[model samples]
Target: MNRSARRDGTPDRGRGNPARSASDKRATDKRATDKRATGKKDAPGAGRSGGAPKKPHRGQANTAAVATNKRGKPKQAKPQRQQVEANPTISNAKPARHQYVQSAGPVKLAAGEGMRLQKVLAQAGVASRRAAEELIEQGRVEVDGHIVVEQGLRVDPENAVVRVDGVRVVVKKDLVHIALNKPRGWQSTMSDDLGRPCIGDIVSERVSAGQRLFHVGRLDADTEGLILLTNDGDLAHRLMHPSFEVPKTYLATVNGVVERGLGKTLKAGVELEDGPAKVDAFTLLDVNGKQSLVKVVLHEGRKHIVRRLLEAVGHPVKRLVRTDIGPVALGDGRPGTLRVIGPGEVGALYKAVGL
Candidate 1:
């Protein structure tokens, strides 16, 4: 046998083509090394598919380690993770905190606590809810002295000072507004210093303690009719102010017949002792042989204005009873009777003075 031949009759690796021998030895060594490291054989046809086993990437693998099943099919390996025990005494999360801030504008009432502003105005007889909203939109309504335009704004009506058209509205529960039918001889004064019959005697038993009221306008000792008495000073002042021009109505019995042209003359404005005055309206209701029952409407508050106006027309008044003031009327109420003004009437009065 040749000295370099193997016992199987194959050329000895050390005796084959030198370069080819080296390459075959390296290939054999690589396969043996890979088998030792992986403890597994190459997949069938793996060498023909890619020609070589690729080295691991520079970084750790992102994929899970793979394994083979009983059928030699690859399956994902269960991930291995370090186990950690929880410590009840320590936590990394932070707790939450709550805070609140108040505003400088009108105080905001909590939910379901106070009444709506427009409703308050409506209840206080300022206007209907719809009209009150319109007033607020026009920048004419105020609450707690600030012009509030927001609808449904909550308010404490008893505490809030509301105004419309610059006229203060009385909303407090303790404040009283009364309409008294004065007797013919009852003085308009709150209290008669001379011990004569006056308004105080009539209202003293009707009102609560400490509720002192003042008359809006005075009537003569002989005149009788509807007179407003209230603790609302602002309303009284506005009603009495000449610029407001709140019309008053009177039923007067005068001597001699009222001429047809008398109403025209009275409305044309008759010159009075203090100033020129005019009747807003006039109507002759009934005619007797020598006396006439006439209705006169005027905005003047001059002393005995109704009597003076009638006398100026050549028919002197014998008895004059005011039937209405602004939106209020006596409505056949007996003498010395007192009635709390209704909300509608009060609202009408507020509108009359531009409130």
Candidate 2:
């Protein structure tokens, strides 16, 4: 065994530690000193955690800067705006320029004129809204040299050029709401079956074929009086709905004079096999020795409700005549004769029924 540096100040450089020249030994020592001073590491990924170099943070700069992409390269960004209204702040901002838009709707040729296209055709008494739509589809309506097939298309009236079936239409001056005093022995419908005369027959030349007129309500072939016919559908429906509870007055000719307490029983409420019934008000107006005409005012449109009510009170109705319904009555209206129900008369009926 030989030792390079013995315990004594003597050199034994041989065998295991080969002897080196002075210059070579100096060079080797310089390398070890340089490594210690520069802190050169042995491992390839020295000072790195989990085999990865830590990413540069917001405040930190790159120790070894990488070359950037071209000038056209885009920067990494968050999600982009999705739709027009996504940003409320931008949406609420004022426009940079004045915005003006014109609708392709029906226009009145004259200034200050206001009317819908479908309604203008209907007012001209040509046809109804549905019928007007048909006219448009048939290419009969033209506006400003353009055939308008779209019913939803609106136009300027005065400037707009319109022709229906090649005929110019003028919206009518006014609308009419007329009622007829329906006579008895005739069905309350517009037309009659069983070859019987209808209430429409009694209305005379007032109702034109082009006008859309219908009865507000119906009366049985036997139930006569105040038959209201009008072109107004909304009024007819509201007046007929049971929720309104419109009072209808009737004059019923019963077999016997109603008993003394019979009126009380009716006023109190009488139970029928079908259901209970109540009269708003009742009074025995006449009694001619076992014959009587009882005027019944009730708010019911049930099938044969008046006759059934009389029957429930032990008085079967022989003949029934409706005197009034809601705000109109059959005044001096003969069995088969009719008169126009005036506004004054209608007003009284409204008060009587509290409409």
Best prediction by lDDT:
1
lDDT of 2: 0.65
Off by over 4 Å in 2: 1-179, 341-355
Root-mean-square deviation per candidate = 19.9, 17.0
lDDT of each: 0.82, 0.65
Pairs of colliding residues, candidate 1: none
> Alpha carbon lDDT of residue 104, candidate 1?
60
* Superposition error at 168 for model 2 (Å): 34
Q: Write the per-residue lDDT of candidate 1 for residues 77-192, one digit (tens) a residue.
A: 67988576788988867765754444365776976988888888887777899998899888898776677877788888767767777666766777788899999999998777
What TM-score fits each model? 0.59, 0.48
Question: Candidate 1 has what TM-score?
Answer: 0.59
Residue 7 C-alpha lDDT in model 2: 65
**For every model in order, what is the number of clashing pairs?**
0, 12
Error of 1 at 49 (Å): 81
